[model samples]
Target: MTDIYRKLYTSSMMPSINLPKHYNYIGAFLSLSCNLSCSYCINHLVGLDQRRKHLSGAEWVEGLNRIQTEGPLPISLQGGEPSIHKGFIEILNGLRKDLNVDLLTNLQFDPHKFMDLVDPERFKRDLPYPSIRVSYHPETMDLAETVNKVKILHDNGYSIGLFTVAHPDALEYIPAAEQACEENGILFKTKEFLGEHNGKLHGTYHYEGSVFSKEVKTVNCKTSELLISPEGHIYRCHHDLYNKITPVGHILDPKFQIDDIFRECTYFGKCNPCDVKRKNNRFQNFGHCSVEIQDIE
Candidate 1:
């Protein structure tokens, strides 16, 4: 039997997902299962349950191709470790040509095999940062091995870089990674750690007091990015996506659509800092927040 798939579009046709009209970004979680289980992994704290079924590669391609967005903004392939997905490269090359593609990976794959299968320009762009971002974990990863892999990919003309978390313990190693990357002409940067460590919270969040606490309150929330879970479920914020909380709808259901309106959420205090934080606006400039929350009830 030939497989048939559905498409998700506007709200009038089907179920509504509160989203901004102009989706500046889209994140497709190929799989929330990662090889290395870091203790500080926000996925675990955010209520990311691995039991959810992951969509097949074909389902992902079909679902992603149906996104009707209006911008040069790319669809980011992310997750516990996006590269670990069975069809990582296939999904990367499978996206619509009009839609730019980006990746957030740990660079644990074989680079030679990746380069031989995929073209360079698929991830290339005239941007301030590299299209492919490799995350560096000092405790769970070896610095030398990670750096070597990054250098190999960079030398091959692939637009790639390194991003390390600024954990309290890892902060001391950030400068070393940065200097190493700079010496090798690699773009190495740090991302603020979101969860609590050593009894203190890190990261600059937009909504004050919106994490870890058991407090749940109703609030109106909207997002600028298109967030998809490993099961192809679309959500309004990282809070919903990671927390296994309420999802607006599923992608490629044809019945699923973007509402482009603010909706009521009961998990306000438990919001993911990534969604509530006021951070860079793609240009690496500060003060750009991912979600706008209001009507605290």
Candidate 2:
């Protein structure tokens, strides 16, 4: 069955002729469960009532291995906290060697255990950013302990860096955290805060009235990223993923192929901030949006 799926994916999905593919990033949400619950969590922006079912480690390996990408494209492992996935280490080791791997984490796991189980070379890719990005949340995480854990990973030959969102409530602590990271020889970066804070919207978005609006509108939309849910279902955008809407395809489906053309959407005003926010592309150019939307009504 795996061989048949691989063949179908290679023949129909891989070739650019059948699917109009233009994916710059691929995200794998191993699980939506996180240990820390940050108040400004984007995953909960649309409400977190829906509990997603997760695929086994073996299933993840089979489905993900079918993906064919060029250049330094890697399948990023992330979630509420990807490390919390029961089969996290297994999935990491199970991926094909040729496929580059990147991790987005909260640095809450034991670095010693990770280093013992996983080889550093597995994540070594020639990308501009480090393979492991540890998010520093002041609200829930201890700054000193988080720094210590990142340093341990860096010392053990892991490409790691620290990123903190500049939320309105967290702004005062960010400067101090940045100084600590710099002092420790760790790369510290700040991400623009998204969502509403004290009656003000934080980040810049491409479309007007796309986010935080109560009313829903119809629009044509297309995305540049491949977002996969824990259950192996492919989503059109983050909004669909969090809202438990219909999936575009499933990774395990032999006939599943990317259709890069724009599709009609009726939930424009209730869009996730992550999809509509103006941000940098792979080339680091500003004003790149994950999804392109048109015909707003």
**Clash statistics: count for each candidate:** 2, 0
- Model 2 per-residue lDDT tens digits across residues 1-297: 445566656533532212234567789989888888999998877554367678888778777877778677788999978898888998999988988999999988889999999999999998778899999999999999999999999988999999999999999999889999999999999999999988998789999999999889999999988888888889999999888797998878776788888999999998999899998776567888999898886
Regions more than 4 Å wrong, model 1: 1-21, 46-49
Clashing pairs in 1: 6-252, 7-254
Predicted structure 2: clash tally: 0
C-alpha lDDT score of every prediction, in listed order:
0.79, 0.86
Q: All candidates' TM-scores?
A: 0.91, 0.92
> Clashing residue pairs, candidate 2?
none
